[model samples]
Target: MIRVLLVDDQTLVRAGFRSILDGEADIQVVAEAANGADAVRLTRELRPDVVLMDIRMPEVDGLEATRQVCADPRLSGVKVVILTTFDLDDYVYGALRAGASGFLLKDTEPSEMINGVRVVARGDALLAPSVTRRLIADVVSRGRRPEPSPRLNVLTAREREIIAVVAEGLSNDEIAARLVLSPATVKTHVSRIMTKLDARDRAQLVVLSYESGVVTPGWLS
Candidate 1:
């Protein structure tokens, strides 16, 4: 089963998410936290497979909680999927950089939300399409120029191409189709890239791709 921890300051939002996730056969709402501090504590104690984290909260926010969770060597198996209103681009970007596996808009459809949980639980990152655009715009607007990692030179030409495509928010299957490679092959390449870059997950890979200049905001538009 995919165990999940719901972390939101709003009681009604937590209840609603519980109601949606409770109906899924493969998912279980293991616990709930009203703030980021509680969420981090429960995460270390319970070690749920996924954390549905709200970006804003009292005392500690989701972004900091996510950072703490990701940085904890003991909670390495835990994955955080940020929950926000989609307008919080800065928070979303910060969450991803803090090692969040992905994000979900608070208004996401029930089906999509469930699927997103499953995706991250299975070790895949899940950035929403709109979130990807917003991330790029936010990065560009901040004047944080892409500082291509020198380590990028370690990637093969093909791997560099794949990284660019990944930054475009394409799935492994979509990348396979575009590159005329098998899905298995694409997955293998992605794994290798992660290892070489020391990325925590595909979300980190996307961030690296942007900051490393493999993909640019203009290309995204």
Candidate 2:
């Protein structure tokens, strides 16, 4: 079963998510927390597969909690998914940088939310194409210029191209179509790229692609 921990300051919000997620036989809502402090505490104790976290809280916001959970060696298998009211939340990037696997708008469709939990629980990021565009726009607007990083030196020219396309938010199938390759081939390339960069998932690849200057913000336009 995919164990999940719900962390939200509002009782109603937590209840709503629990209700939607509990219906899935493959998922289980293990616990709930109203603050980040408790969220981190419960995470260490229960070690759920996924954490649905709220950004704004009374004490110890989701960003810090995510950092704590992700940074813990004992909690390495845990993934944190930020829950936000807006698609373009200001804290989304920080949360991602702090080791959050992805973010979901609180008002997202029930099906999408359920799938998102499953995605992150299975070690994939929840970065849909739309979310990736917005996230890149936000990073560009903040004047985050790409700089030289030797971490990407291990990648071949083809691998670089694959990573660039990945930053554009294309899935393996989409990338395969664009590159005139089989989906299996594209998936292999992506896996190789991730292994080279030590990226946790596709979201981190997007971040690294931009930060390492493999892809520029203007590519989006």
Candidate 3:
């Protein structure tokens, strides 16, 4: 079962998510928290596979909670998915940089939200193509320059190419079709790239791609 912890300041919001997610056979709503402090505490206790975190809270906001959770060596297997009211939430990028696997708009369709939980639970990023573009745009608008990492030197030419395509938000199948290779081949390349960069998942790979200068905002144009 994919265990999930729901963290939201609003009781109704947490109940809504629990109701939707509990109906899934593969998903279980293990616990709920009305604040970030409880969220982090419960997370350390339960160690759920996925955490649905709310950004704005009374004490210890989701961003800081996410930082605390992600930074914990014991919670490395846990994935945090930010729940926001807006698609381009100001806290989204910060949460991602702080080790959140992805963000889901609270108003997203029930089916999409369910699938998103499963995606992150299985160690995949919940970033869709449109979301990826908007995330990149947000970063660009912030006027942040590329802060390259020495880890880029470890990737091969083909791996670099794959990482760039991944930053474009293509799935393994799509990348395979574009590069005329099998899906398995593409998955392998992505895995290798993640290992080399020590990325937690595809989300971090995307962050690394931009932050490391392997992909720039101009590339999208």
Candidate 4:
């Protein structure tokens, strides 16, 4: 079973999500938090497999909470999927840098939201194609990606190409079609990219791809 923590400030939103998620046999909500502070505390206590975090909260806020949770050595396996209404570029980049596994719009369909939690639980990257584009924009808006670090140097040219496609919000199959490669080949490239970058998941890859200057903002379009 996949254990989850719901961390939205609004009672109604939290309740609605809980209802939809609880109906799933494979997912369970082990705890809930109304603010970032509670989220941090509950995260350590429950150690849920995934955290569906809200970006705007009264205390500490989701970004900081995600940072705290991700920084914890005890909860290294925990994954955070940030939930927000606005696709504000800053929040998207901040959450990823803070180590969120992925980001999802609050209005996301129940099925997609369910899949997101499960995906992160399995240790996969947190990006859905649409979300990747936003991350790319955020990286480019800051003027420079490819932070002066060797973290991204591990990727080969082919792997870099794959991440570029991903930043365009292409699905594995879409990437395959566009690149004139097989879906299996696209998947292989994505996997290799993840391995080389030490990216914990796709969400981080999306951030790094943009931040690391692997994909430019203009290239996203």
Candidate 5:
């Protein structure tokens, strides 16, 4: 089962989300926090599989909460999915830099929201964060780049190509078509890439791509 922690300052919003998520057999609403501080507290206490973090909150905002939660070695395996209605560049970039596994619009359909939680919980990435891809490109282009890491050199040529495709926000089928390979083969390559890179999944792969300069931001296809 996917254990989830819901973090939203609005009570009604939290109730609504809880109602929807509680209906899913595979997902369990493990905890709820009214603000970022509470969220971080509950996260460390519960160590949920997925955290639905709002970008704005009292005391500590979701961005800082994500950073704190991610920095904790005990919660290293937990995934934080930034949940917000705004598509502002700041939120996108900030959430990612804070180590969010993915970002999703709260206005997204119920099906999509459920899927987003599931994907992040399973350590896969959401397909609709193209805005994040754009932000990553912009941020790196503006010179807020990270230092080099030799660990990035471990990716094979095929893994490097897959990472580039991921940075472009291409779906698996699209990547398969572009590379003249089958979707299953593309999935295998992606899996291997994640294993080799020590990435929890594609979301972390996206993070590593820009952070490690494996695929430059502006250079994404």
Candidate 6:
């Protein structure tokens, strides 16, 4: 089962998410926190597989909470899915940089939200294509890119291309079709790339791809 912790300051929002997620047989809402402090405490204590975190909260806020959670070795298995009210919310970018696995608009469909939980639980990246595009644009607008790092030289030419496409928000199947390779082969390359880059998952790979300049923010468009 995928254990999830719901963290939001609003009682109704938490209740709403719990109501939607509780219906999934494979997912369990293991805990709820009204703010970032409680979220951090419950995460260390319960160590759920996924955290549905609200970006804005009283006191600690989701970005700092996510940073703390990601920093804790004890909670390394935990993946945070930030919740935001706006698609273009600037806080979403910081949350991602803070090691959140992904973000979800608060108005996401119930089915999509459930699927998102399962995706992240299985250790896949979960940014929507549109969101990914917007996020890259926002980062570029702010003049941020990966600094010069020797870590990038580890990837082969093909692996570099694959990582760049991944930052473009394409799935393995889509990438395979674009590159004229089988999906399984694409998956293998992605796995290898993750290992070489020491990325937590594809999301981090995407982040590194941009930061390393293998993929630029303008290339995302």
List CA RMSD, all candidates. 1.4, 1.9, 1.6, 2.8, 2.9, 1.8
> How do the predictions measure up, each by TM-score?
0.95, 0.91, 0.94, 0.83, 0.82, 0.92
Question: In model 5, what lDDT does residue 205 have?
Answer: 74
In model 3, the Cα lDDT at residue 100 comes to 91
The prediction achieving the highest lDDT against the true structure is 1
User: Per-residue alpha-carbon lDDT of model 5 for 1-221, expressed as tens digits?
Assistant: 99999999999989989999999999999999989999999999998999999988999999999989988889988899888765565776777766787788888788888988987776667645666566668766776766766886888788788887887777688899999999899999898888887665576777777787767667644
Per-residue lDDT of candidate 1, residues 1-221 (tens digit): 99999999999999999999999899999999999999999999999999999988999999999999999989989999999875787788889889998888888899999999998998788964765655655665566676777889999999999988887778899999999999999999999999999998888888887777787766645
Question: What lDDT would each prediction earn against the true structure?
Answer: 0.88, 0.85, 0.87, 0.81, 0.81, 0.85
Residue 186 Cα positional deviation in candidate 1, in Å, after optimal superposition = 0.5
Output the worst ten-in-a-row residue range by lDDT, candidate 5: 127-136
What's the CA error at residue 100 for candidate 2, in Å?
A: 1.2
| Superior candidate under TM-score, 4 versus 5 | 4
Candidate 1, position 184, lDDT: 97
For model 5, the stretches where C-alpha displacement exceeds 4 angstroms are: 127-129, 144-150, 171-177, 180-192, 218-221
Tens-place lDDT digits, model 6, residues 1-221: 99999999999999999999999899999999998999999999999999999978899999999999988888889999999876446787777777888888888899989999998998878865586667755675576555767897888889988988888777788899999999999999999999888787777887777677776576545
TM-score of 1: 0.95
How would you encode candidate 4's per-residue C-alpha lDDT over 1-221 as one tens digit per residue?
99999999999999999999999999999989999999999999889999999988996899999999988889888999989766466876788888887777888899989988887898666676555565547556767435545775777778778887776556688899898999889888888887777666677776676776766666545
Residue 13: error of model 5 in Å? Answer: 1.3
Kindly report which residue stretches of model 4 are placed more than 4 angstroms away from their true locations once superposed: 129-132, 142-151, 171-189
**Candidate 2 vs candidate 3: which has greater lDDT?**
3
Off by over 4 Å in 6: 144-148
Among all windows of 10 consecutive residues in model 2, the one with the lowest summed lDDT is 131-140
Best-to-worst TM-score order: 1, 3, 6, 2, 4, 5
Error of 4 at 183 (Å): 5.1
Off by over 4 Å in 1: none
Q: Give the Cα-based TM-score of candidate 4 against the true structure.
A: 0.83
lDDT of 3 by residue, 19-87 (tens): 999999999999999889999999999999999999999989999999999999999999999998664
